[model samples]
Target chain A: MRFKWSNVVLFFGYLFLYFPLICIVIYSFNESRFVSTWTGFSFKWYKALISDPIILRATVTSLKVAGVSATASVILGTMAAIIIARWGAFPGNTLFLGAITAPLVMPEVVMGLSLLMLFVGMESFFGWPSRSGNITVIIAHITLTLSYVTLLVQARLQDLDNSIEEAALDLGASPLKVFFVITLPMIAPAIVLGWLLAFVLSLDDVVIASFVAGPGSTTLPMIVFSSLRFGISPEINALATILMTILSIAVIMSAVFIYKDGNIKNM
Target chain B: MYRIEEIIISWFSELMKKIKGRHFLVAIPYGWVFVFFICPCLILIRISLAENLIASPPYTSLIEWISGYMLQIRINLGNYMVLFTDEMYIRGFATSILIAGTSTICCLLMGFPMAYAIARSSEKIRGILLMLVVLPFWTSFLIRVYAWIMLLSPCGFINNLLIRLNLIEAPLQLMNNSCAACIGIIYAYLPFMIFPLYSAIEKIDYTLMEAAYDLGSSPLKAFFSIVVPLAIPGIYAGSALVFVPAIGEFVIPELLGGAQTLTIGRLVWNEFFGNMSWPTAASLSIILLIFVVFPIVFAQRRREAKLSIVD
Candidate 1:
C-alpha cells in the first residue's frame, strides 16, 4: 500500500467510527463494576443485565415499539412513496409532500415537545388513547420515520422502469393488479430496507419517547439516557454491547441483501 | 403449471377490479400523516399561544364556549413575548445554533475527505467502506455517546493512557463541556455528511477533473473549480441534515455537557420535565423550529424545482 494521504484519511476515519464500538464491546466483558476500569474478562455484566428487570422490560418495550412502528411506517411510507413517484400532481399533492418530509428536517426536541402537547390535547378532547404509552410512542415513531421510508422508496420507484408495470396494465390487468403483482414486488427490497431503517431509528430514539412516555412505558434509550446522567455503568455497557451486536447484524444483513439485490450496484 | 397460472391470473384480475375502485391507496398514509404528524405541530402552535396553567394538562385552552351563540377564543401572545423577553431562552437558541453550526463544520471537514476517498476508490472497496460508515449508525446512539464518556472521564482511557505515557500531570476535562458535545455531534453525524457527499462526489464525471487537468489547472485549483461546485447540493443536504438535528440534540448535550452547557434542546427538556412549564417549552420549540426549518426547506424545494426543470 502506497502512503497516500487519502489512504491515511480513510484509515483514521474508519478508526474514529469503529473505535468506540470496539471499546464498548471489550469493556462489556470487564469484571470491574466501573465502566472505564480494566479488569479481567467476565460475563458478570451480561449476567446482571439478564437478571435486571428494568433493563429487560425496557428492552422489550423498545423492541415492541420499534417493531410496531417500523411496520406501520413502512405501510404508510410505501403509500406516500407511490403517491410521490407515480401519482404525479394530484389534489393536495404539494401539502402531502411537505407534510411527509417535514419531519425529516424537524428537530427531535421540537417534534417531541409538539407531539406531547398533541397527546395532551387529544386526551382532553377525545378521551381516547387516554394516556401516553406504547401506543403513543409507536405513533410518534411512525411519524418520525415515515418521511425516511418515503424518501428511500421514492428514489427506488423513480429509478424503476415503469415499462414492466405498463406492460402488465396493457395486458388487461387493472392498476391494482399491476401494483400488487408488479410494482410492489419490484420495490419490495426498498420496502424491506425502509422497514429496517425505521426499526433502527425507532429503537435509537430517546428524546421523542422521553416526552411522550407515560408511567411504566420506559424504552431502552430512555433507560440508557437516564442511567447516563448518574454516570456510566458496567451493566449499561453490557446492555449497549448486546444492542450494538444485534443492530450490527441487522445492518450487515441488510447490506448483503441490498448488494445481492443490485441496490448498491450503482453506488 | 399453465392451468395454475390461468387460475391465479383470473383470481388476481377479479381481485384487481375490486382494488381499482379504491385507487386512492395513498389516502391511508396521507390521512395518518395529517392527523398524527402535521396536526401535532399545529397543536404545538396553538398551545404556544395559550396561557400556562397550573392544571393536569398544564395549559389553558385557547377556545371557550361562553354561550350557546358565541365562542370565546383566547389568543395569548404572552408565551412568545416571554420567550423573547427572557435572556435565557435567547442565549439557549444562540448557543444551540453556534454549537450545531460549529459541529456541522467539523463533521464536514472530517467527512468530506473520507467520502472523496471512498468515492474515488475501487468498486469493491467503496461498497465495504460505505457499509462501514453506515454500520455504526445502527448501533444505539446513546451507547455511542456513552463510549465517549468512557474514553474521556477522569479515570477513562485517554487519561489513563496519557498518564502511563507521562504526558499529563492531571486528567483533562474532556467530558461535560460544549467541546465534548461538539465532538459527539460531529461523530454522530459524520456518516450523515459522508453519505450525501459520497453520492454527490460519486456522481461527478471524472472526465471533468481530467479535462481541467489537461487544460493546465493545478489539482487543487481543479478540485475547487470543478469538484466543489458540483458537490454544493450535497453539501447543502448534508449540512441541513447535520445542523438541524444537532441544534435540537438533547441526549448528546445533556450527557456530555455539564451544568453550564445549555442548548435549546436541553432548555426545552428542562422547562417541560423539570419546571413543568409546558407552554414555555412549546413556544421555545416552535420558535426554534420555524426559524431554522423554513430556510432549509425552501432551499431544498428550490433545488428540487431546478432539478426538475433540468430533467
Candidate 2:
C-alpha cells in the first residue's frame, strides 16, 4: 500500500491515545513510590492494593451496582428500542424519543443533581428509601446507562429483517413466542453489547455516584477520586493496571466474538 | 384453594389481555424514564426556585399552606441571581464554555484524519481499528485522567526524559493548567469524536471525489470541496458529543485544570458538596441544563424538518 498523510496522522493519534495508559501500566510495577522515578520491578503495590479494605469494599459495591444496573438497563432499553424501531409512530413518540436520547448528552453534574433531588423528594413524601445508598446509586446508574443501551439496541433492531418474526407469527406462534423464539435470538448480540456498555458506564461513574450515594456507600471510583486528591499513589497505579488488564481482556473477547458472529452470518 | 387460584389466574390473564402488548412494551420504559429522568428534571427546576434552608433537605418548600382554604407560594430568584451576579459563578460558566469549545476543536482536528484513515482501510482492519478506538473507553475514566497527571507532572515521564537529555534547565509548567485540562479532555473524548466522523465519512461516495479530481481539482481542493462538505453532519454530531460532556466534566478540570481553573462542573460540585447549598446547586444545574438541552432540541427540530421536507 502507498503511504498517505492520513496514515501518519493515524499513527500519531493512536500513540497519543495509548501512551499515557502504557505509562501507568509500566510504572505500576516500579519499586519507587514516586510515579516518575523507576527503580526496579516489584509487586509490592499490588499487595498493598489487595490488602486495602476501603478499596475492597468499594469494589464490591461497584460490582453489585454495575451488575444490577446493567441488567435492568438492558431489559428496559431493549423494550424501548423495540417500541421505537418496530411499533411505528404513536402518541407521545416524540417525547419518548427525547427522553431516551436526553441522557446520552446530559451533563453528569446536572443528572446527578437532579436525581439527588428526586430521591430526597421521594424520601420526604413516601418516607421510603430513607437515604441514599446502593439502591439510589443503582437507580441513578440505570437512568444514566439506559440511553446508551437503547441507542445500541435500536440501531441493531432497525437493521434487522422483520420477515423472520412475521413468518413465525404466521406459523401460529403467539407474538410473545415469536419474540422469544425468533426476535430475541437475532438481537442477542446487540443486547449483550448493550449490557456490557451499561456495566462499564456504571462502574466508571464517579460524579453521579458521589451525588446520589450517602456517606455509608462509596463506590470504587469515589475512593479513587478521594485518594487522587493527594496526588499520585503507587496503589492507584496498581489498581489502574489491574482494571486496564481486565477491561482489555473483556473488550478483546467481545470484539472477537462479534467478528466471528459477523463472519458466520456472512457465510 | 384451587378455585381461588383458578379465579386469580383467570383475572390476571384477562387483565393482561386488556393491555395490548405494544402498550405494555411502551409503558415499561416510558414510565421508568418519566419517573427517574423526567421527574428529576422537573424537581430540579422546582428546587432551583426554592429558598435555601438549614434543614435536612437543605431547601425550603416552594409552596406552603398558610391556613385552611389559603395558600402561600414562595419563589426565591436569589439563587439564580447569585449565578448571574457572582463573579465566581460567571467565570465558571465562561471558563467551562471556553475550555470545552477549545478541546472540542482540538478533538476534531486530531480525530478527523484518524477516522478518515480507518474508514478508508480494508474491511478486516477497519473493525480492529474501530475496536482499538473503543477499548480505552471501557476502562476507568478517572484512571485515564490520572494517566495524564502522571505524564504531565513536573517529575513525570516527559520531564524526566527531557531533563535526562539536558533539553531544559527546569521542568516546564505543564501540569495544573488549562492546557493540561484541554489535552486531557481531548485525549479522553477523541474516540467519541472519531466514531461519528468515521460512520459519516464511510458513507460518502468516493466517486464524487474522483469526479472532482477528474475536473482538474487538486487533491486538497477536492477534499475540501467534496469530502468536508459531505462530512458536515458528522462534524456536528461529533462536536455535540464532545462539547456537551466536556462542558460539565468535573474530573478533568478538577484534576488537570488545578484550583485556578473554575469550570461550571467544579462550581456546582462545590456549591452542593462544599457549601451544602442545595438551592444554589439546583439553580446552577438548571442553567447548565438549559445551556445543554436547548441547542440539542433545536438541532433535532432542524433534522426533523429536513426529513419531512425529503418525505
lDDT of 2 by residue, B123-191 (tens): 877877887898888889999999988888887888888988999989998989899999999999999
What is each candidate's fraction of native interface contacts (fnat)?
0.85, 0.84
Q: For model 1, what is the error of residue A199's alpha carbon versus the real structure, in angstroms, after optimal superposition?
A: 1.1
Name every residue pair that clashes in candidate 2. Answer: none
* lDDT agreement with native, every candidate: 0.86, 0.88
Error of 2 at A14 (Å): 0.6
lDDT of 1 by residue, A1-267 (tens): 322878999999999999988988898899987654677989999999899999889989999999999999998898888889987987888998998988887888888888877887788789866554688898899999999999999999999999888888889998878888899998888899899999999999999998888887899899888888887688888888888878888888877887888777532
Give the per-residue lDDT digits (tens) of candidate 1, residues B84-197: 888988888788888998999999899888988999888877778888898888888888899898888777788878987899989888988889999899889999999889
Supply the DockQ value of model 2: 0.74
Q: Score residue B114 of candidate 1 by CA lDDT.
A: 90
